[model samples]
Target: MTVTDTHTHLYSDAFDDDRKVMIERAIAANVTRFFIPAIDSSYTKAMLQLEADFPNHVHLMTGLHPTSVKENYMEELRHVEELLSKRKFVAIGEIGIDLYWDKNTLEIQQEAFSHQIRLAKQYRLPIVNHCREAFDEIFVVLETEKSDDLFGIFHCFTGDIEQAKRAISFNMKLGIGGVVTFKNGGIDKFLNQIDLEHVVLETDSPYLAPVPYRGKRNESAYIIKVLEKLSELYGLSQEVIAAITTENSKAIFKV
Candidate 1:
């Protein structure tokens, strides 16, 4: 059973001590595909090095993360555009308005989000969005940009049935991760109501670790916990969940 972790920060310093061993552990557990998201230009080198080292396993996305939107955001967006012009990427992603960290930057964040969405449309690539405490704001931008070309994964989706359906209307697949395993993670209550085709699996590692590793650092191999939870929720076997989610991922990433 091949598993795809649609979102993970393999280049994160969290894995610095045992990057190779940690990735190998995930591979041994059948989590072979790792889609890496960009935060800003600073991590670009590290992300590229990760791809160079794990050429077959790693796929990369290019964009300016919402939280990283600051005074030099225009410069950062330029970097994103330059990268897009130079090489191929799976998507323009992990981009959206994040009001949680700093509400003051909402305007800039929305501007960045809209700009990146246009970039994704121009490149004919999918988008991998990162929305946090700004569903209304994110939806507003998505509403303005809605088109046959506007399609991607709502990375780390945690919303109500109405929000989930709204995201689907924009052609986004819900990126289900460790949150589903949490007892209070409300999405689990209504997730099965959504078709499996509209969902994809992720770890968002080295963060949002599943149940057993809740308070601890997360790794790709721990995605199994997420898979098991999804199997239980969807009334399917782990293998089948893995197959369907991986196929859903392929449909989005085109990889």
Candidate 2:
């Protein structure tokens, strides 16, 4: 059973002490594919280095994270443009409105999100979105930008059935992670309702680790706990869930 983590920050600082060990642990558990989301230009080198180290496992994405947007955002967007022009990445990602961090920059966040979506369309790559506490805002953008040319995963998705349908309408697969195991994650109530093919597995490592490891640092290996939860939710075996979600990941990332 080959499992895929559609969103993981294997290059994050939290893994500095034992990144290799953590990765090997995940690999041993059959977590074979790793999609790394880009935050900004500063981490580009680290991302590239990670891919060089694990060329077969690590697939890179390029985009400016919404929370990373600020006054110098145009410069950052330029950097994104330059990078896209130069090399290839699996997707344009982790990009969307993050009103939770700073509502003040909402306008710029929207601008950056739209810009990257256009970039993704231009490059004919899928997008990995990072919507947080801004569903309406994201929907507004998607409503206007919806097109056959636009499609991707809504990374770390946490929303209702209606919202899930809305995202799918815009050509997005819901990225399920640790949150689904949470008591109040909400998606659990309606997840089984959505087709498994519309969902993708992710750990968002160094972030939303599944329960049993909740409130603690998350590693890619911990994704098994999430796989178990999903197995239960979908009435499928862990191996089946792994295969289905990994197939879903391949459909979106094309990798």
Candidate 3:
């Protein structure tokens, strides 16, 4: 029963103290795969070091996160493009619109998101989207960039069934995470309507910890809580959820 943590930030400063222990704990819990998303040029070195540290277990993606989009967004995008030209990354991702934090940068966020999506298609790499409070904005860009080569996971997806369907139509898999385990998370309300095939498990470490660890810093090891919730909601065994979702992840990352 191997589980995949499709979204996690091993490079996060939150893990500065005991990152190795956190990963070891996840390994012991049978959550072997760790997909790391890039936030911006700032974290590139740390992210690369993480991949080097856990060559077999960690997969990396490069992009400018929406929240990181600032006035100098183009320079950041250039850094991302430079990385894409040099190294091999599983996807071009953790990219999308984020209106929750600041609405002022909405335009720049959209530009960066759309530009990254185009880069993903150009490189023939899957994307890892990070959208928050900006589904409408995201959909608009996705609608324009909709193409066979443009497909990836909607990382940390917490939208409704309609949004889930819309994401899939644009060639994205719904990334289910700790929120699915929360009693009032709301995503569980409509998750069953979507097939497990379109679903992929994640932890989004240092954020959105599952039930037992809610309100605390999340970690990849806590993906078990998510698996448990999926088991209960779908009436399937944890082993089954792990198997199917891990397979779906493999299909996306091609790892």
Candidate 4:
């Protein structure tokens, strides 16, 4: 099974000690494709270095993360624009509203989110969204930008069935990760209700690691735990789940 970790920060400093070993561990576990998301301009060099190190396995995206939007956001957006104009990226993400960190930046976050969505449309690329505690806010922007041209994966989706349907309505595939394995991680309870076609798998590594490793740094290798839980929920084999989700990722990233 060729598993695709649609959202992972392989360039994170958290893996400075053993990034290569960690990635190889994931690849050995069948998690071969790693789509790297941009947080801001500062991480761009590291992301590019990661791609250079693993050209066949790593795909890069350029965008300003909502939390990274601060006083000099215009400058950051300009960096994103410059990157897009210079090179090809699989998508324009992981971009979206994130209110968990700073509620004060909501306005600018919405502006940045909407702007990136337009950039995605302009580039004819899918977007990988990063929403946290701001589903309603995220939806408002998405609603205004709704069109056949707008489509992507809602990275680390942690919403209810209604929200899932709404995201799907906007042509987004829900990105399932370690959260589904938690006993209290609610999404697993109703995940099977959603068609597998509208689902994709991700690790969001160095962040939400799956159960048995929760609270620890997550790595792409741990994605197998997610695949296993999803199998049990959907009454399917791990290989099938991996295959389908990987295909769903391919449909979005087109690589």
Go through the candidates in order and give each one's C-alpha lDDT: 0.96, 0.92, 0.93, 0.95
Model 1 segments more than 4 A misplaced = none
Model 1, range 42-91, lDDT digits (tens) per residue?
99999999999999999999999999999999999999999998999999
lDDT, candidate 3, equals 0.93
Model 3 per-residue lDDT tens digits across residues 1-255: 899999999899999999999899999999899999999999998998998899989999999999999989999999999998998999998999899999999989988998999899888899999889999999999999998899999999998889899999998999999999888889999898789999999999999999888999999999999999899888999999999999999999999
Report the lDDT tens digits of candidate 2 across residue range 23-87.
98999999989999999999999999999999989999999999999999999999999999999
lDDT of 4 by residue, 63-178 (tens): 99999999999999999999999999999988999999999999999999999999999999999898999999999999999999999999999999999999999999999999
Stretches off by above 4 angstroms in model 2 are none
The lDDT of model 1 is: 0.96
Deviation of model 3 at 115, angstroms: 0.8
| Alpha-carbon deviation at 159 in model 3, angstroms | 1.1
Winner of 2 and 4 under TM-score: 4
Alpha-carbon RMSD, candidate 1: 0.5
